[model samples]
Target: MRSIVFASGKGGVGKSTVTLNLGLTLAAAGKRVVVVDADLEMANIGILLGIDATPISLHNVLSGENEMQDAVYAGPNNMRYVPASLSPEKMERLDLDKLPSAIKKLDDSSDFVLIDCPPGLGPSAVAAIKSAKEIVIVSTPEPSALADALKVRALAERHGVKIVGVVLNMVLGDRSEIKKEDFETVMEVPIIGLLPEDVEVRRSAALQVPVIIRAPGTAFSRAMRLLASRLSGEKLAIQETKVKKGLFSSIMEFFGRIFGRK
Candidate 1:
């Protein structure tokens, strides 16, 4: 599996949201995707997917109490997930040395392993960056998120991890004026996608579904799908797909109503 970790040094920048959406987009295209919640302190990917945290989790796998395979929970779009432990105290005592073995098992059977890492420069986040072949940094358009994103980007480079690109979330209305040149200058990495701030994203999560599935046609969904395609080595065909109906067309209609026909 292609190992990619979604990371951000700052919290509340929507790292897990982006990771899960990308996984769902890829899985819908027939890829075997597995999402691992390496964010030990605040593991909410399962919750976002309406999955209840089980007794067996990442902590158990890392502690050698159970095989990683035994803890994976199946989800929609042929995607699978492994939630972090319910016990934060026990989670703090995670064995980093055992992490690699558990991740490798996920790699063996899946087409992609998307890790949702914890926020900050903690051990769990570091271990995830080490395990990743490529890191997709998720950040918002806000200045604080940008500063933290740069720090995370530097950390990934220091570890010799390939930087896949940056995903800009919580975008403002009308992304047309958000110059690509400006973003690249500030980020100093390829701006792979820009997810507009939309209620659809949160509503999709509330409904236990990926935004890409719910609103594939919006500027946000199109950007997400484009990112997934790029990761899979496919050329960006945003316009052609945008011109098509059904999948991509459905979501944009709803988005237009909310953002004043943007």
Candidate 2:
């Protein structure tokens, strides 16, 4: 199985959101994908999926209260996910050491195992990083964020974990934002993806649905599909969406054309 961990140096970089959607995209392409919420302290995969409560989670497996398979739950698009417990009691009993073995059990069944690691260089993050065969750093187009990512890259290199490039999220293409080449130059890792900030993503998360499922034709979803194709080495089809132009659309188009703007 391809064990890939998605990590970030700083929080609020959309690491969990990108990881979840990528797993779903892979699953949609007919690959057996499993996403594990390894961010034990602030596990939000369940919240993103609109799952308020689960009987068993990663905490249970680590605490030896349940098997890894028992913690796996069904998700959309035939994808399976291992959500982390939100309970403070379970968090207290979490055994980070057992995480590796617990993840190992899923190797036989899954083609791809995507771990959503916690931010920073904490013990939990280190444990998750060491457990993965490869790591993908997620960052924004900011020096501060990239600086933190560099630290994570260093940590992964120290452990000899293969760096699978970086996923640059929430790219707005503003002049103030760092260029792609600069990011690569600073981190010494290629940018594997450039996910744009889309309002649809926010709407989907509010509805407890992934953007890929809720709005596949949107730019964000298309980019996600392309990213999945690049990783899977298969040219997955991009779904095209047709829009009906109304009076509002015509007016906007006319103004956009006149002003040479969107």
Query: Residue 19 lDDT in model 1?
Result: 89
- Per-residue error for 139 in candidate 1, Å, reads 0.9
The residue ranges of model 1 lying beyond 4 angstroms of the native Cα positions read 173-179, 235-262
Ten residues in sequence with the least summed lDDT for candidate 2: 240-249
Q: CA lDDT of 120 in candidate 1?
A: 86
CA lDDT of 175 in candidate 2?
92
Tell me the lDDT of candidate 1.
Answer: 0.78
Best candidate, TM-score: 2
Give the per-residue lDDT of model 1 (tens digit) for 97-136.
Answer: 7876788888768999999988988888899888788899
Q: Write one digit per residue (lDDT tens) for candidate 2, span 1-262.
A: 9999999999999999999999988888778999999999998787776664588999999888999999999987778999997777788777899998888999999999999999999999999999899999999999899899999999999999999999999999999899999999999998989999899998877666677877887888888988898877789754332322331224345335434577
The per-residue C-alpha lDDT of model 1 at residue 34 equals 94
